[model samples]
Target: MTLRKPPIPRLLLNNVSCMRNAQQILRHVNVSVHDGGALVLKGTNGSGKTTFLRMLAGFTRPSAGEILWNGHNITESGVFHQYKLHLNWLSLKDAIKEKFTVLDNVQWFEILEGKQGKSMAAIELMGLGRLAKEKARMLSMGQRKRLQLARLLAIDRPIWLLDEPSVALDDEGVKLLEYIIKEHRKKGGIVIVATHLPIEMEDPMVVRLPPRFPRRMTLVDMLDRSGLD
Candidate 1:
């Protein structure tokens, strides 16, 4: 009997740029990540950290350049859908159902459509086991954040896109998040985190975006500026 090695996944952003309301948000940004690697996106508010993740998630298209998932263009016909199968996204918004129990939220048999894995690891890792049967709405803000992150382990996806994952988490929760990331990376999974707060990752590739400021105006510029036709 022969065993086959797993495929090495790659995510590439070639000279990507994003625009909003006729203004540039991200300019000619480039990124590349493969199996077992991590990318940390750090920036101030409105600096486009979330925009970068959204672009990778296929929620929005880039204004220019290409997004390649395992050498296939994500925007190509039928590619985004396939790429989605590998994504485990943690957005700013929690996906918890207020009425669902904590354990049930991560183990939603009907609402979630995919292979369901054991949710106990995530429940124990996030310290939510004690509240397993409690309704999600009864949990506090930090608990909600932890519950939202528990989705990362529910499906065993290869790629994780975390947006501001540390927002409502405390020191212990943050540490647990890092530990989970390390274990995932060690298992050949890729992670991409967009956050204002610093996170600990093993030799992570960092992308820093600075706040965009409006073009400066001067008397000579005002005189030379052209009027709209």
Candidate 2:
């Protein structure tokens, strides 16, 4: 399929300000991501990477600011088809259906999304070929991570929002993720990852959120758990 112009500045945040529990989280932050660009969010926990991502995904409302997509404000549609058309997301939990087999889960996703392809090929690409028939509940943590990665390849979205994609991944899984990211960038896809892991990418932009006062343990430990230490 021929790709569109990518709508320069695929995602734009204008004077974004967010707060939680009466505490200001983000302060008039403005950022833009162009086609084929990469943006990495790095901060100790409570830095609001997840909250920022949620706002981008339209799951949470920002206290102030506008989110624009392809020159249009996203507040109207509330992150629907127009936004989903070119977006895909992956978090650390691996959220693969535990009751389904690897191949079955992939097949189900394809069916639900009205997308189809060579399932075995996709699994093999993620090095999960041998576990194709294994149920998600039966797979190892690393294997589950591969399953999540496989979703990226199968869906082929232009914009990827990944929250800690490397969690639970082994050495080989990390290598596979690197390869996948490289290929995605080559294909003109945009990636926004909220992680502190040392990823192998080409000059990816990094955004570090300010530290929250009171030295919250939950706020500091999540970033450390991201494996960048």
Candidate 3:
């Protein structure tokens, strides 16, 4: 019998580098997210986790290296929209239109994604059925977080890039995030998350980023040097 090789990763970053205000934010980072696996990014605040996510989302271009998907380099691919279609990103702010009701916000997102009927489904999944009609600005912090998560359920994607998903959440909200992540993994989806604390996960590969750097180096190079490769 032929030994099977793992399929190509769904996402890849090779030797990526970035800088802001003359300060290097990231250096020569290389990461791969295979289908059905999770990569946890551990770092302190301002450690470039969000910036890295933005680069992956095509919001910013890397100063060096390439961002690839299944061996196709999206750098200069000039089709960021296509890449965004497959990526589901939840940011720290959990931005919700203050003027729109909870139901309206979810509904608008569904319409935007062209996923009709998902608004109600998402609201129910997030256990927000009771508060769907409440204004977004009126909802408590936990409620807002739930609403943000509802959007994730509504827009199912292969890749989930979550930034500090548990911020300002009660125990219930944390459990909801945990449940969603486990379910997504069970469905063979990929997850990359940046968090300050260790999350309860079943044997996920962990990568911790230092808050300060002695010299400029790529993440891949650092990993290789640290025997983490």
Candidate 4:
């Protein structure tokens, strides 16, 4: 049986703004991405890079704008659940379950995502084949990062939202990451990465978040967090 590919995906951010502690961290940000596209988000700490990625993931709502996926408003309650089905989110934390073995962790993710026969291949691709049975707690920081990438590959999602994905990686590991990302884009995957380190990918678009921000916390910020806003 032949498998059918889904329609090409697109993500759009229009007139987006974000505030925390009552100060604006991002102002009127606008960007768009289509299938096979890569976007590298650059900004200093507190520059709202995390916020922007979270907004795209439907975890954080924009202060004033729309985040659209395939021309549908992703921020809407009815659409968020469906929107995330296509996403693979890698946040600051590696999301590794320390009690599980390397293989177990990867396999668990594949199970959750309803994929099969892919975990071992992804483990080898991330250079963790030799350590596949080792407990997660025993892996070095770099190896743990690689394991996260392996999980990423195993699930085979089309949209990737990575935050500081290259951190703690050595030179060789970085190269492997670049290779994975480059190939993912070739297959029409959409990636948006937030990082302080440089990532070399295939013709990726660079988005520099606004640096100016109010350092003071505001009532709106407190309200948002407390679910009162």
Candidate 1, 124-144: lDDT as tens digits: 778998999999899999999
Global lDDT scores for all candidate models: 0.86, 0.83, 0.82, 0.88
lDDT of 3: 0.82
Each candidate: how many clashes?
0, 0, 1, 3
TM-score versus the correct structure, for each prediction:
0.86, 0.86, 0.85, 0.87
Clashing pairs in 2: none
Candidate 1 whole-model C-alpha lDDT, 0 to 1 = 0.86
Provide the RMSD of all predictions against the true structure, rounded to 1 decimal: 6.2, 7.1, 8.6, 8.4
Candidate order (TM-score)? 4, 1, 2, 3
Candidate 4 structure quality by residue, lDDT tens digits, 157-216: 999999999999999999999999999999989989999898888778888877764557
Which pairs of residues collide in candidate 1? none
Per-residue CA lDDT of model 2 for 145-194, tens digit only, reads 88888877887789898998887888888999988998898888998898
Better of 1 and 4 by lDDT: 4
| Candidate 4, superposed: residue stretches over 4 Å from native | 1-9, 212-229
